[model samples]
Target: MTVARKRAILTADSVPMLPAHVRLIFNEKRDSWVVLAPEKILWPDDISVLILQNCDGARSIGEIARALSKEFSAPFSEILGDILEFLQDWSDRLLIRLAEQSGGKP
Candidate 1:
């Protein structure tokens, strides 16, 4: 019998990081950023590059959104919503994972 692992649930407080099998790199030949997984490559646009670069496993979703909002002069709410959706999509694709909680709280 096989147990299906549950997918991670993303939230405002979730700290996103690239999984061990995933990497984000600048493809010089393509002159763009690409996400490399075991069997897949994703070419992200400029805005997505900004978001992916900030997923350092240390900042929460809210923190990232706040920084992006300030950098682009966009509204916080809009940025947050976009970030949440973006992260969730990547998380579902197994490219990103939520960092383990530091404290004893789950």
Candidate 2:
């Protein structure tokens, strides 16, 4: 997926996912995981991997942050900024596609 010239403003209701051509793979050769975007390959840190896994085009951004907060043992308010930053960065890189959410989904 290509990053749009006009980016979408992410919100609590936004659901993000990797484009079809983009994927996360365990690169045995590199001894690490990598995000293989159509334009480039990226090596992400552990926290990044967790963020990527959460972007399944289902969970909203708020839900994603809450889950991450639990996993990292941090308060949601404390981690929210960092989570937003990561999502925005990846979205700008076309590693994630954000969808508009109407309401909470089961």
Candidate 3:
């Protein structure tokens, strides 16, 4: 038997909204870190929102893939691979936590 690894993902609609109590914002336009705790809102300039927000606690890889397919109008298989790659990069940076199923599946 092999061990399971957690995967990170987020939905397109929920991407603009951060979790309660958590604050995040980007400031490439001004070169700063804009944070709003207790009132999280996605900045229009924040591209990471699309890549990171799908990382909800229990959403599966397949679920995210379908959602992204509609959102980007791209092929499911391609979007799936792309999202996986994006998540891997974020995981390496410690930006988000990977979802771990009780069993051994992403």
Report lDDT per candidate.
0.87, 0.80, 0.53
Global CA lDDT of candidate 1, please? Answer: 0.87
Better of 2 and 3 by lDDT: 2
Quick one: best TM-score, which candidate?
A: 1
Candidate number with the higher TM-score (1 or 2): 1
Q: Which has the higher TM-score value, candidate number 1 or candidate number 3?
A: 1
Query: Each candidate's TM vs. the true structure?
Result: 0.91, 0.83, 0.51
Tens-place lDDT digits, model 1, residues 1-106: 9999787788889998887788899999978999999989899999988999988888899999999999999999999999999999999888878878323121
In candidate 3, what residue range of length 10 has the lowest lDDT sum? 10-19
lDDT (Cα, tens digit) per residue for candidate 3, span 1-106:
9986544443332222233344555668977445454433434334355545555655665677788789879999888776666655544444444433223222
TM-score of candidate 1 relative to the true fold: 0.91
Candidate 1 at 53: error in angstroms? 0.5
Alpha-carbon shift of residue 17 in model 2 (angstroms): 0.4
Better of 1 and 2 by lDDT: 1
> Residue 49 lDDT in model 2?
88
How many clashing pairs does model 2 include?
A: 0
Q: Which stretches of candidate 1 lie over 4 Å from their true place?
A: 101-106
| Candidate 2 CA-lDDT value | 0.80
